[model samples]
Target: MRKTATTLADGRELIYFDDTEPYTSGAATRELRDRRDLDPVAATSTMRYDVLTGEWVTLASHRNSRTFLPAVAECPLCPTRADRPATEIPAEDYDVVVFENRFPSLARGAEPPATDHVDGDDLWPQRPASGRCEVVCFTSDHDLGFAELPLPRVRTVLAALVDRTRALSALPGIAQVYCFENRGEEIGVTLGHPHGQIYAYPALPPRTEALLRQSRAHHARTGRVLLRDVLDAERRSGRRIVATTEHWTAYVPAAARWPVEVHVAPNRDVADLTELRDPELEDLAALYLDVLGRLDRFFDGVGKLPYIAGWHQAPVEEGRELGRLYLQVFSLMRAPHRMKFLAGSESGMGAWISDTTPEAIAARFRAIAPGPVPS
Candidate 1:
């Protein structure tokens, strides 16, 4: 693989990862400069600590002003043209590109103004939103979905993520690195391009904290890895298992809260994406493609599904022993024409109630053969 990093017009970092031999072998000539004259935007975000919930809430009001879904010609993720205004990517074409988010929820090394609220007070203390948020464009095409990419392309995407994970973890204050994709409008995707995001947080998020607590307690109690045990239990039951290969297993979690949820875990206990072997990555690409193909046709009338796919890896500074690498892919679509809303029980009370059972969902996923959706 070939990797090149450059600074965008606004002083943010943009990188390109090429998988072709010509690029990797340094036999292809390329334009490595960004050709736009843009002024830097003064943006900083603050984080308030929720004393009641023990969580951090980022206040990035500027996100409301970011671009929404635009026409294909005005898509910000597409390559730039000489006759058109320069988009986020300055290059005319790219295989996979990653850059810092223009409207970021968290800014690296940014210092927000201090507040007069008492630090000892229950719910008044605040801090700077010091971290990073990066956007990873999976393909240059405006209409391509991740599942439609070829395996070699998928492998390259994985490689890009792996490199970012390692690089982001080494950043001075980053605590956790989250790589995820929000696809389709139902998933609250403002852009229609095939892309995912990476969030490098200064503090461990609540979800990862809870996971570490569980993992540590489980290890202390059973002396076995938590994720490995879960995988074994699923394999033994065979009720929620969707698909399994020599290196990985994809299954609907036994206590799934979403209408459609699948967890694809490696057969061996791996700390993060950077630890996966070459054979493991290849097998992962194949299995992930299969699972996504089934998801595209889950509903009878919906040709493509709206979903969120995220990787839960070990935190950068802590929980290295108990942290495990895995992916959780779930959709919000409840039926052919219905949607799953986080109503009172879910959003207001923090309790989730799914309409479909895990076994049934697993069976549905298994029954659907991998194929293209009807045009």
Candidate 2:
């Protein structure tokens, strides 16, 4: 893949990952100039410490005015055309492009307040939400989704993600990086475009922290990697296993809280995407596409299911040895034409109640899978 980085009209960074013949061979080049007149990005978000949970809550008030669902003609994610107003991407067409988010929750240039405490209270500390957020356009075609992308295109997208993860991890004050996709209106996706997001956080997220604690405790007790042990147990049981490749495995977690949840983990220990070998990455592209396809077919007559797919990577400076890379894909759809809503038990308290068992979910997935996964 050939990566070309450029600056947007408003000074934000935009990158193109070209994998096609002309672009990749250097016979042609991507349009580097963004000619549209755009306002400067002013990131005024702040991070407030949640005393009760010990987590940082980013307050991006400006995001309230972000672009919502728009008509196809006015979709900002579409490639810019001469006949139409310019969109976010200035190129006439692109294979895969990534740009800094216009409405970012955390920004690299955010300014913190003079005082550290909120209203002189030591319990509530506040700081600038200094980090990065980028949008990855899976395909220029708005009608196409990630699952429908061709194998080469999927590999290109994966390359872009790996590149961003490595670069974002090196940024100042970035403790952890997260790459995720939120699909469907039910999942609160504002745009109809097939895209994902990368978040470079200033601190480790609560989920990462929890995973680290558990892994550390497990290592102390058993002298073995926690996730590796879990994977071994799942493979031994084979009850919750959905699919397995030479370098990866997909299974429904034993304690899955969602109605439909699957965890895809690499067979070998890898802390992050950057550590993946070429063969592993290739296997990942195929296995991930296969899993996503099954998810769409999970509930008959449901059409495209609303789900969230997130990458869990280790922190840049902490828990590197114990961290294990994995992908968690889950949906809110419990049945056809029905959705699962997080109510009192889930929303109020930090507890989850599963509507279905992991074994049952795995059985359904196996039934829909297209036989054994390719070796």
Candidate 3:
């Protein structure tokens, strides 16, 4: 792959990952100059400490005015063409591209707040939300979804993500790096373009904290990796197993809370995507596409199933040894026409209630599995 990095008109970073002939061979160059007149980025987001839950909540009020469901002609994610207005990507076409978010919840180079307390209360401390948020455009074809991508294109996307993860993890004060995609309108995806997001957080998220606690405790008692053990147990039980490959396994968690949930783990223990070998990455691309195809077929008449898929990686500076990398995919679609809303028990409290059992979900997934894809 050929990687070319350039700056946007607004001073944000944009990168292109080219896998095709001329670009990869250095016979041609990507359009690096962003000529459109644009204003400089203004970052004013802040993080307030929630005393009750011991979590940091980012307040990016400016995001309220962000672009929402614009027409296809105005989609900023599309490639820049002469007939159309210049978009976020300066190139006329691209295999894969990633750029800083125009309206980010977190931003780079933010100055520290003058006072740490909120309303003179010692419990409510606040600070600048100094972090990085990026958007990964999977394809220039605005109509194509990720699952419909060719295998080579999928591989390029994975490579770009691994490259970003390594680069983001090396950045100062970045606690964790997360790569995720929210698909479909029901999943609250504002953009119809095929894309995902990368977040470099200044602080560890609550979910990572909870996972670390469990892993640490499990290691202390048994001296074995928690997730590795879970994978082994799941393989032995074979009850929630959805799909398995030479390097990966897809299964439903025994206590799944989503209407449809599947966790994909490496057969070998790895802390993050950066640790995955070439063979493993290739296997992942194939398995991911296959699983996603099955998900679309899971609910008849539902068309494309709206789901959230995220990579759970180890923190940059903490719990690396105890961490096991995995991809968690879940959808809010409880039925063909019904949606699962996080009610009082789930949203108000940290408790989850499931409408279907994990075994049933897994069985359905197994039944609908598309077998394999051509290389």
Model 2 lDDT at residue 179: 97
CA lDDT scores, all candidates in order? 0.87, 0.90, 0.90
Candidate RMSDs in order: 2.1, 2.6, 2.3
Q: Rank the candidates by lDDT, best first.
A: 3, 2, 1
TM-score of 1: 0.95
Candidate 2 residue-wise lDDT, 58-77, digit = tens = 99999998999999899899
Please say which candidate is ahead in TM-score: 1 or 2.
2
The local lDDT score (0 to 100) that residue 190 gets in candidate 1 is 90
Task: Provide the lDDT at 273 for model 1.
Answer: 92
Q: After superposition, how far is residue 91 of candidate 3 from its true place, in Å?
A: 0.7
Error of 2 at 131 (Å): 0.8
Q: lDDT tens string, model 3, 153-178?
A: 99999999999999999999999999
Superposition TM-score, candidate 2 onto the true structure: 0.96
List the candidates' TM-scores in order: 0.95, 0.96, 0.96
- Residue 230 error, candidate 2, Å: 1.0
